[model samples]
Target: MKNSRGSLVRPHPLPESASRPVVTPLSPSVVYASDTPDALDAQYEGRVHGYTYSREGHPNADVVAARLDGMEGVAGGVVTGSGMAAVSAVLLGLLKAGDHVIGGNQLYGRSLRMMKEDLPRLDIATSLADPGDVKAVEAAIRPETKLILVEAVSNPTLRVADIDGLAKLAKDRGILLAVDNTFTTPRAFRPFEHGADIVIHSITKLLAGHSDVMLGWVAAKDPALAQRLRVFSVTAGLTASPFDCWLAERGMLTFDLRFERAQATAAALADHLATLPGVKRVIYPMRADHPDHTRAAALLQGQGCNMVSFELKGGREAANAFTRAAEGLSFAPTLGDVGTTLSHPASSSHRALTPEERAALGLSEGFFRVSVGLEEPKALLAIFAEAVAAAVPGA
Candidate 1:
């Protein structure tokens, strides 16, 4: 096949200096430097040259980073050992002793923990906002705010953030907008196209598809930023294993297909659950009743995704019963897998939160999260109905 302009795709070549003299290969010269007895600079190549050590760079990591770059539609990208590693890389890269960050109130628990712990310790500060509230985000900004971060789709609640709006706000404020795109995946929401300076994903979740590996990555338009982050990833020394990278590469190919089926199932399942007798509320992007449904319609390319959250009228008693009755279902605390997985966010993912904090985020003991899977929609519905019915607390 050929392009309309009749040109063949070609690989970018290494600079001339890199192709000869096995240029400056790392050795005992210094643990972190070239190991060869010969003076390292004698065979120097361009700065983009290969590893002086695996901590600096690795061929497999490069392969994974390029694959992630293509998926994220960015000028450059990097893979880290986990999602937090990528987040920390961006924070460490942009934040200084006195800088501050503004972020959505619905943050991953670890992120909340990090801010409450690390930033204060470093003399850097942070501001929190409900990303759903434009006014809240706007007001939270301080003169020291250097970044505004939000998840494209929040965990547990599945609140689809006002991505374009937040990105624009960040741009207007000269703040970097780094979006955590894990929940929505590249298939559901492409944040970079909406003005995000950086898009990060927890490849361990939907990206790997099968839940066999743990990896995270960041994609960005600025090659300089990407290159800088690549250095940070290396110096931080948390690059994914070569085999894990290989698995992620393989898993990414089937991402679209898997999520398409799962999303349909999710919609069906959520719709039915919402109509059930004891169901108080169902939160998913496409549902018209969702608080952010309008923003979801504008920001999400499709009708939400494969995650759903619902509250039971009976609170913790009903939630616990529903979980206990999940015989055939996987009652796991994890999300995004082939098997239908359920999690009780108030206790599992957000257990670290103070009662007041959990209430502020609308995550309560009655809230149950469901990661819909590739199973037939009807079967999922039947299982859900049966579980809910059997566990009716008042019954």
Candidate 2:
């Protein structure tokens, strides 16, 4: 097993100065600073040095991967360019042409595209089902099915899947179950604990916390599967950049603190939004009204995660008005940032879906998804209350 260049396959030795460290301990290296040509050779050879190329592997990425592996209780793992890349790697690494996959209809829009559009192009077939519905999932399985892809908590609409149930179904059928645990970090939920075969994370979200880094991670329950995933990442050039890895690792250090604060804020907001004048409905797993409140509570450790999806009574106009009036909140398309931000799925995340498709998923024109931040819940509630009052006509 050699990379494009013929480098010796050996471990990259630690720099002699590694013994010394700062107060917090930071291990950041652009390249494995070591004996030059031999190091280069070692990299090409995919040797024991821990990393060969920045694209294939790096020290920063290694730390993040290791930390994630520990948190998820995985046998091994790899970080990728983005969450989507991790999704691509899992499908590409584990399945080939003529293979069939069962994908959730509730996946993020781009993920849906990957399964609906890209998989077919690769000669792989996929059937979309409600990942939370055990019977529906079982019915969708085919003789050629090799994988079942699901999100622990669905995007925008906040549907929670039954990971343990799905895992049993997959195992009984000899199929792999990959759970995207991005929404609920390991602090809230670890998919592996539920017998998931592969756990995936869009480290860009809560794991990274700051929304500055774009990275993804795939943790495999089996070392052999991890090796295969690593090979796909290296060969396919889907590995994460070292700097992003460093940022992601830094983010993980305070993950518990950040997640706790944001999740609390999200729960409070969900409760408050239901009483707001312009609010039509609020959707959060913690809410008694949520479709999967009980299941989510059991699987997610009684945390609502750092997200809340709500609809404005005034429809799209009110949604737009609230965004325009909301002070200090960014109208960003992405989620899991340190600061509170509002994203409209009809216009951003699920914009690709046709009107009928969006409607089918319950993503209405007034739908607004809030990525709860670390702000004080009272202050955030004040801001939203004022914004809603200003936005809703005659309120």
Candidate 3:
């Protein structure tokens, strides 16, 4: 018999059985053991289907990647620690120094910062263009341009990119087009279907649908690109934790249902908010007044995205008052929660941009973005009505 210390260190393995688990088991072990060194080598060399280390690859990550691959209709995919990690994997893994990249002007603030600030430090060149204008993107491309990055539907402002036109341009130019689909998710739009080479997602957002886990993924239509991203993700140590992956998968189980309800509420809210007093403008892709409404209608499915952005006439002071007066709504800097939440763009998402840059994008101090939740529509409308009244005062 073994001593107490030895027994405590090594617990008995569960007995093998024919029964299978309905949910994917969380395998958090950092390392795995094999029968022989040769077996381990085979696993590491990809000669067999197994995991040797969590950083290189793990069961939970693989399962989630496969699910994303199916959803995005890609050849393969890799999940990363965060949305920015996935973005970095693509930028760093695929491109090298001296290569040029064309990015949309309306990309997520952090992503735009990477293109504008970070890539230049690494000797890579970047140009910003209006993704809504395909000709403008093509004009920005140069001989060394290797990639064109755009969001399917832009952040905060809700500008829709012309993916098909951009994809064709990239193909004609022999460059790759990467679309960030976090705002639209696969339910609203699948970039691969529109001839995009790569699809990226901040799984922390709508896909997970609960705002609980921080995760992201990149899916490539080409197997080689997917492999490159996976290799770099491991080398850079951007792999996600097993527990976060498990929670993300659990949240995704109700993604379709949750997305539908939230988007429906968003459409109603957008219409109602536009009619409210002191409302300067409302930004939603489904709305006819949106600049990209036609393109959005062509690209998006169902009711479009679950996000709504509105500006108040009273500016910053009004925004503060509205947040204070809104009883049921929470003032969250982030989005995609079970309950309706509000985000102030100038303070949170686009805080890095200078006043001139934000003004060019029409992101004013009173501009607010809403992530519609599963709350009753009537209650939400009432909350907004009262909040707008408090903010505008006599409006």
Model 3 ranges off by over 4 Å:
1-8
In model 1, the runs with Cα more than 4 Å from the true position are 1-49, 393-395
Q: Best to worst by TM-score, what's the order?
A: 3, 2, 1
lDDT of each: 0.79, 0.88, 0.90
Tens digits of per-residue lDDT for model 2, 1-395: 55644364655565687465642344445455556787767756768455544776777777888999999987578999999999999998899999999998999998998898898999999999998899999999999999999999998789999898999999999999999998988888988889899999999998888988999999788889999999999899997877788788888889999988999899999999999877888999999999998998888879888999988877788887889899999999888889999999999889989999999999988888999999888999999998888778665
TM-score to native of every candidate shown = 0.87, 0.91, 0.97
Ranked candidates (lDDT, high to low): 3, 2, 1
Residue 61 in model 1: shift from native, Å? 2.4
Candidate closer to the true structure by TM-score (higher is better), 1 or 2? 2
lDDT for each residue of candidate 3 in 66-98, tens digit (9 for 90 to 100): 888888887579999999899999998999999
lDDT of 1 by residue, 1-395 (tens): 54654364533433566456422232222123454635455434554354556555566667767777777787668888888888888887667899999877898888777777887898989888888777789998898898888888888778778877887888898888999998888787788898999888888887787767788898667788877787777777867776777677677778888889989899888899987887778998888898888888888855578899998878788888888886678877777788889888787878989989898888887788888888877878988888888677443
- For model 1, what is the C-alpha lDDT against the true structure? 0.79
> What are the per-model numbers of colliding residue pairs?
5, 10, 0
Predicted structure 1, TM vs. truth: 0.87
